[model samples]
Target: MKNLKKYAKAIILLTVIILLVCFSFYKISKSRSSQFFGGLTSHVNTEEKIIALTFDDAPTEYTNEILEILDDKNVKATFFVVGKNFEKYPLEGEAIIENGHEIGNHSYSHQRCIFKSQTFIESEIEKTNTLIHDHGYKGEITFRPPNGKKLFGLPYYLNKNNIKTIMWDVEPDTYVSGDADAIVKYTVENTKPGSIILLHPLNGTAGEADREALPKIIDELKAGGYSFVTVSQLLKYEN
Candidate 1:
């Protein structure tokens, strides 16, 4: 009976350890402010009123509309584009580059990138980087995982390739989907100095709220004495 009690205690301890490990990994995978690997930046460290506006999954039909808005506002932002979309709409991708906006890789197939094979992660990052290069974007290419889901393999590959993983400090449209006013309000309220804001202005109808909120967000931030910069430019302020 004593041996059986010892075995029970051992099993309980082992189960507790396994649960702790799994819970730790879960937190690390979804953490925006921390990662197990190198160089994951959600917001820069600065006292200046500078921010970066990052649009994810780019070069869709809404590309020109977004570009035109930014052009009218004379704001330079960053575009984290997928390889498939960039290839599908090379002209649109070039337009973003031509307009002097920074380009970052948003992976090839837009997969989760969690628990993926090393080869799959490599191909996703390398092929997207190559495509971004082919689009005449002569600048440092950062990366943002598809759904902000990355574990060991993705971070390992990004760190190995010397790419900084970009995340966001403010994401309004994600919470207030299809509500432009709410998005604007949320962004204006949440934005701080050196913040990185993520918006999905390139997806189809689902991005309408972001597209509509873009000008308002920009206007409010500009009114609040905030100037926009690309992710790379924002990183320069990091100390």
Candidate 2:
């Protein structure tokens, strides 16, 4: 009976330790700033009134609409496009380039990168990079993992290849759901100097609020004397 009780306690302690490790990994995978390896930029550390406006999962049919709003505001933004979507919407991808915006790779299949194999990770990024190059994006190709989730394999591959992972400090669409006004308010309120603002204006109906809020967000930020820059340009201001 004594031995059984000791064994039970040992099992409980083991289970608790396992749970803690799992929980810690979960939090780290979802973290915007922390990673197992490589340089991750959630927001550049600077006091300049300049910010990078990044739209993820792009080159969908809504690309033109988003681009139009940015053009109207005379703002330059970065689009992290998925490989398959970019292929399907070649003209839209071309349009993004034509409009003088920067493009980054957002993976080929847009899958969650945690616990994935290194080969799989490399394939996803390389496939997307190839497509981006084929589409004539000449600027530095940065990367943003799908769903902003990454762990050992993804970060290791990125670090090995010297690819900087671009994350965002401000994500209003995610927190505010489909409320345009709320997105605008949250973004405008949370934005600071050197903030990397993320939006998902290409996500079909779910993204309508973001698309609607884009112009307002830009106008509000510009009103506060914040100038927009691309991800590469924003990196230059990092201290």
Candidate 3:
């Protein structure tokens, strides 16, 4: 039955090709600043002495401390908060706005953005955006998927709906240990023109370093003549 053997081989080859295409889609979607559809704004390309300080995760108990430091330094930053985290801590989310900072939608559940359905992707972004709005955040709501991952469905929706995907160019806390002084030093040493720095000051004990590093980072950056802007604002200044 040579014909039967040929049919079997054909099936196997088709399967292999299907798997390869799926894997490629996965890789492209999960890229930090890449996509197959719409616009992806990770970091700006500029020589101006401006940078964006973006924080991911909750408006946790440490929100007040961070806001106070930013206030004293006379700098404005952006907070990308999750829908569920905001639901769990509504006051902190509101405080982010009350204290005069930009707010972004991280996701509804802070789940990974790859290998998920279109409905799931839609819910993750839309629900968080709704929640952020409920908390009185009326600014242009940009987005940052959890862990900077996105696949086709997420980007397609974001692009179609005109939502900008934000990522960071410098993340010292994420690379090194999440310690306050350590992160502060790393940020100071690594910051460049038009850099978008991501910080996680909530979600766990690992983020405490960001809390400690926030004030110092602000002071140092100001001293170095770097002004903080929102991710969208930073994009406007791109070269």
| Winning model by TM-score | 2
What is every candidate's alpha-carbon RMSD to the true fold?
1.3, 0.7, 2.7
Superior by TM-score: candidate 1 or candidate 3:
1
Judging by lDDT against the true structure, name the best candidate.
Answer: 2
Q: How many steric overlaps are in each model, in order? A: 0, 0, 2
Output the better candidate (2/3) by lDDT.
2
Model 2 alpha-carbon drift over 4 Å, by segment? none
| lDDT tens digits, residue span 199-219, model 3 | 887646877777778888988
lDDT of 1 at 15: 100
Clashes of 2: 0
For model 3 the local lDDT of residue 200 reads 80
TM-score for all models, in order of appearance: 0.95, 0.98, 0.87
Every candidate's lDDT: 0.92, 0.93, 0.83
Q: Residue 98 error for model 1, in Å?
A: 1.0
Q: What is the lDDT of residue 196 in candidate 2?
A: 96
What's model 3's lDDT at 183? 89
The order of the candidates by TM-score, greatest first, is: 2, 1, 3
